[model samples]
Target: MDCIHLTGIRSYGYTGYLPEEQILGQWFEVDVKLWLDLSSSGETDAIEDTVDYRSIISLVQDSVKTSKFALVERLTASIADSILALSDRVTQVQVILSKPAAPIPDFSGKISIDIIKKR
Candidate 1:
């Protein structure tokens, strides 16, 4: 299998258990890996023969930015499911979501969740 990696996808979303987090919103970063066979695309060099990354980008943005969820797990699942639904070529997907400004009092690093889904 081949992988198409998209990293540092940032969006503003309302997702958290805390009321303030929902009200104020936060910046979420996403990294996605789409696994598929790329032989046809490599041979043909045709857009239709491969995954359209722009469409994937749009789908991710819409999935993350348009709705509110209480858990990053849900957000990640939504992304994975949407990607799987959008393309039959995708045999597997990995989504990583990070919240840089997580509500933890002392932590400086981001809080993130990673999920892998297979078709």
Candidate 2:
């Protein structure tokens, strides 16, 4: 299957296990890979024959920005599910949700959840 990849999508969201995180929010990076057949689109060179990546990005941004979640796992699952809902052509999806500045004292970088789903 052909795939479209969206990487390092940055958004400010409220998704964490702490009070301050919920109130103030933080920056999150999302990476998504969507699997679909692109033969028709490639042959026809028609936008309608393939998934619209800009729309997908908008969906992800809206879903993450306006919502709050306590677990990256749930957030990833939600993203996958939402993407799946958008089109039947999407046979599989992988989502990575990363928090670059976690609240942990010892942590210097990011923590993330990665999940793959197939329909």
Candidate 3:
């Protein structure tokens, strides 16, 4: 299947195990890959023939900004599910959520979770 890759989506959200994280919020980055047939779009060269990625980006941003999930795993799954709900043409989706500001002490590395959903 063909894939649409959307990367570096940044948003401020309040999702974390720590109390301060939920209250103060932090920046989150999301990367999504959508798998679907691109033949029709390639043939017709029309916007309607393919998924509008603006919706996906907006959804990802919204999910991160408004969600209260404590687990990044859950958040990634939710994103995959939500994206799958957006279009019937999408056969599969991969979501990679990155938490660059994790609350772990004495840690300078980032944390990320990747999940894939298939229709």
- lDDT per residue for candidate 2 within 41-69, as digits (tens), equals 99999989999999889888887898788
- After superposition, the stretches of candidate 3 with alpha carbons farther than 4 Å from their true spots are none
Return the lDDT, model 1, position 37: 94
* Poorest stretch of ten by lDDT in candidate 2: 63-72
For this target, which candidate reaches the highest lDDT against the unseen true structure?
3
Q: Rate the local accuracy (lDDT) of all candidates.
A: 0.92, 0.90, 0.94
Per-prediction TM-score? 0.97, 0.97, 0.98
Report the number of the highest-TM-score candidate. 3
Backbone clashes, candidate 1: 0
How far in Å is the alpha carbon of 4 misplaced in model 2? 0.6
Q: Compared to the true structure, candidate 3 yields what TM-score?
A: 0.98
Clashes, model 3: 0
User: Candidate 1: where are CA atoms >4 Å away?
Assistant: none
Candidate 2 residue spans exceeding 4 A from truth:
none
- Candidate RMSDs in Å, in order, are 0.7, 0.8, 0.6
Better of 1 and 3 by lDDT: 3
